[model samples]
Target: MPVPADQAHPLTADVAIVGGGIIGLATAWRLTRAGLSAIVIDPSPGSGASLSAAGMIAPVSEMSYQHGRLFALMRDSAAEYPTFVAALEADAQTDVGYRETETLVCAADPADRQMLADLQHYQQAAGGEVEALTSRAARRLEPALSPSLSGAFHSAGDHQVNPRRITAALQTVLPAIIRRTAVELIETESSSGTAVTGVRLDDGRTITAPVTVLATGMTPTRAPLPDDVPLPLRPIRGEVLRTRLPSGLPPLLEHTIRGIVTGRPIYLVPRADGEIVIGATSREDNREGPSVEGVSQLLRDAQRLVPGIGECELTEVTARARPGTHDDAPYLGTVGTAGRGPISGLIVANGFYRHGILLTPLASRLAAQLVLRELDPPTVPESTDHPATADTDHHHLQTMNPRRIAHPAAENQPQGGRP
Candidate 1:
């Protein structure tokens, strides 16, 4: 059962997060652990793109030739995932679906082999460890691969995690006041039209805090932000399909597979359960609804890569809009102009695109450290507290309890099997 909104406690924290996605939850968890009171406000926590994400932590697999800084950030974040997941599981006492399997990049056509070869050359030049593999040798690693596969490359460091489980675990474990409501930031005061002071919510409630972090995914585009804040964020739509294999379907595709066709890129990821996810068509302009043409094209392309998918049971088809920036790189670090002293008390941590889950651990740590004003412990955030406000409204404020506030919505409710 879902946690009741009426029963949710209301209290001010040292920092307040605007989104409840993986990034926000991870940030809130790290902040609360550092002894600072943190609050996360979102209407639906895990129902966004994070839920529909394929959760591939591929710093090298998704590497590009131009973006060196972005690749460094992703590499740092990927390296932190193991430690992050271990600590989170130990703290939350729940499994977060962490997997350390390597990823394979395959090519089916002779023309596509050059793309893999170019990627191999690029990876080598960028000091990444990638191994060129023949089709026969590739089948040795994953037996279900198509016999007609041309060539492949192996990236041992690439990993994946279940995004839903991570989001659920963060929501369950964090000592944050999770409020299931929409919040809009109303600027109360500014200096030189650059610095922001406080924000007012939609329900006439005002929150005055020393620091506020905007982790509101693509919603920041719609927020009343300053013109100087160059968010440069937009949304990119991706369509994904999920299917289940029969009891004895020979365990097709052990590692994540990517195909570099003449057109866009396509990928397939297999879960621990029988579910195999084939995704992602990138659409530049249209993001209104799921594209039947897109889905059909992906299925056709995926089947061409691996022929055995013809017999799988189609379970679900879903679409999600990733928060993309102008250069496809997330905006991290302090907001405001160089001479403006860090925009007073606001920070922007959005525009992660499809890499939100892959980059959460490091991003959360950086956000928490910025909010807490800590100097040491370079990469991630730890729990800590800040000075509480003098005017504490006990009547209006809910009790200060993390478990009570972050409880799942469906807990303690009668469960009738999915109808």
Candidate 2:
């Protein structure tokens, strides 16, 4: 389905996005609605992390994560999500399956119960709201829950949305999305030195724009950046499976059921369709496809959470490497610059890790704001610690600036600075 070079016409826009995943498409849509011309250069849109994500918009669930600033961003994004989704639905004229239901965190055994209690205390200490419930109380809410539960809590702030539907909705509004791979990035001379001008497609068509966003996840069709900087984006392979419930099957999972089996996190998210998404193995490997052992383990862990899933039909198993950074934080600013980049029109918006689906609203908002020069990059602090430990504020882009090198040592740094 590749477009022939002659058939593809050259175009121009105010903002040109390199990748057409949710991050790129959503940003393009936001810019276009803001009265600026926007175009996305990607062949298959929203088929990346957006498609694999189980859209759990729960900042509350991730309070205990190592990345504190990411938690802040998630919480803030979640707070404004209802309004964002409402406006997006009105504009796109399609339901993205934005469910505002509470997420039930349950325990599987007595030891797990203690862990839940400890987590509750930790959340409470962090000034977060969560209602503790006994096993009986938890089952009263989700009766289909495991009968061997020890304890549970209700995070009222947590919710779920269908990521697939959201991706489709984003694609609906960004009609100028180019279904072609970018063969090269068009960088031009500016006072800031080397800023991206536009993109050159594989078919030899050139689409010029003042700004070009490097939303291209993990793999880039061409090198859009300089060789001096390091992106440090690696493929953290994740295997996710979706199962279809049999006809006349009762509602088994009312809300998103997340549990900590031992130390690993397992989740079973219900979709609007009869399919429930039971994923994912967080493997630190460069493997390409789903492994037999990985898929089996996912099924085992999910069945341990809900035994009824054993009867569900396995609909799909997708294995993809999410763009992961050394610090487990995203790089979000002008590449190879010292924060100020009106002249350097290269904006980075990748390395989202596991929060891609949840961070869409905020990420897209930040992307648009960056394109309009309305917001500045947060400053990344000096630290020997991993990127996740960097103390930075999202509002004060000074400390969390993506332009800084994520890992100074650069273990898996891309060669020649161009991928």
Candidate 3:
């Protein structure tokens, strides 16, 4: 329970996390365990884009994440899931629904078949683990799959977790998660330059801290940076549906199904509780809720690859706007991370796009690592255009830096006439 502004005293912490989503809360948890006082500011946490996540930890399927450092970051994060979830569950005292099931990427037609093969080729080329299966082989693994589908690729190590449960568990351990939105970042002058001092909440309550993290996804309601820097945060709306398995339908799928209809990916995640989540439709139009066409398309595509879906009961249709950067990569470094480093006080860990759920562990780790100054931050990748020669931790950091998108030229130019 958080104290209301009227009754609350001036609170402070070692670090102030400005979003209660998985990344922010998880980072708070780690900081608390490290003996650092932390507070999470979000009116309603875990109810953002996380609500619509399919929760598939498939590095193979998300090969490049629009193709960049996100690929290695996702792969590394997926590798960390087993141990990370185990520890998180132990601490949170709740079952986060971390099931280690394989993923099957199914196709619908000749073009889709070639798409599957091409994905396999890319995955293999990227040194990811994937196996090609004929249509019969795929059905053998997941009999509920349509018999007439073209082909499929299986990633044996991929798995799924319930994002809601994960967020719930995180909240359990992070009781101090403030139920108010942060309205601004307090900054102070430093030898290195401008550094974050704390955050001011919407209720006019202020919490001073040495460090502040901006984990607010999609809509960065208030930007802490100076007028010079360009955050360029855009919203990419997505829609997903949840269904309960009906009794008389084909047996619930045991493997995660990732189907490619035309070019887009349709993920069907199975839960231990007779729930199958069918998602998602990616659209550039930034909207708040699910549209009729978006939800209809998901059901239509899902049923095409797994006909049994038609028998499932529609339990939910969720929609949210994901945060996308101009570079199409996530921003995971300090406001000054990309060559602007002396801005000491702020760390940004948002703009994860569609990979937010999969990137939680790494993002949390990064937040703690950055605040502690435990290690020298990784090199900032020159540009998102080139593929990383190595998948080192530094490579991941360099690629996801928020400063990458803060265009220097655009920073100084006044916007049209608006000051």
Better of 1 and 2 by lDDT: 2
Q: Order the candidates by TM-score, highest first — what do you get? A: 3, 2, 1
Clashes of each: 18, 12, 2
Q: Write the residue-wise lDDT of candidate 3 on 1-419 in tens digits.
A: 33343344568777788887788888888777766777888888898888778888877787753484457788888877877798888887789999989999988988988877876777788778888899999999999999989899889978888899988888887747777777777878756567678888787779888778888886547545666556777888888898987775555789999988877779899998889999888788746779999888888899899898888899999888888887777877665534444466677788888888888877787677677662123223222222223345566776776655644433332211111
lDDT of 2: 0.73
- State the lDDT of candidate 2 residue by residue for 262-377, as single tens digits: 65677888876777898778888767889899899888877776888998999899987788887777767655633432236677788887878777776777677667762123
lDDT of 1 by residue, 354-385 (tens): 88888887677766765655222222334322
Q: For this target, which candidate reaches the highest lDDT against the unseen true structure? A: 3
The Cα error of candidate 3 at residue 304, in Å, is: 0.7
- Report the candidate with higher TM-score, 1 versus 2: 2
**Per-candidate local distance difference test:** 0.69, 0.73, 0.76
TM-score for candidate 1? 0.83
User: What would the TM-scores of all predictions be?
Assistant: 0.83, 0.87, 0.89
Off-target runs (Cα >4 Å) in candidate 3 are 1-8, 64-68, 190-192, 247-251, 337-341, 374-391, 407-419
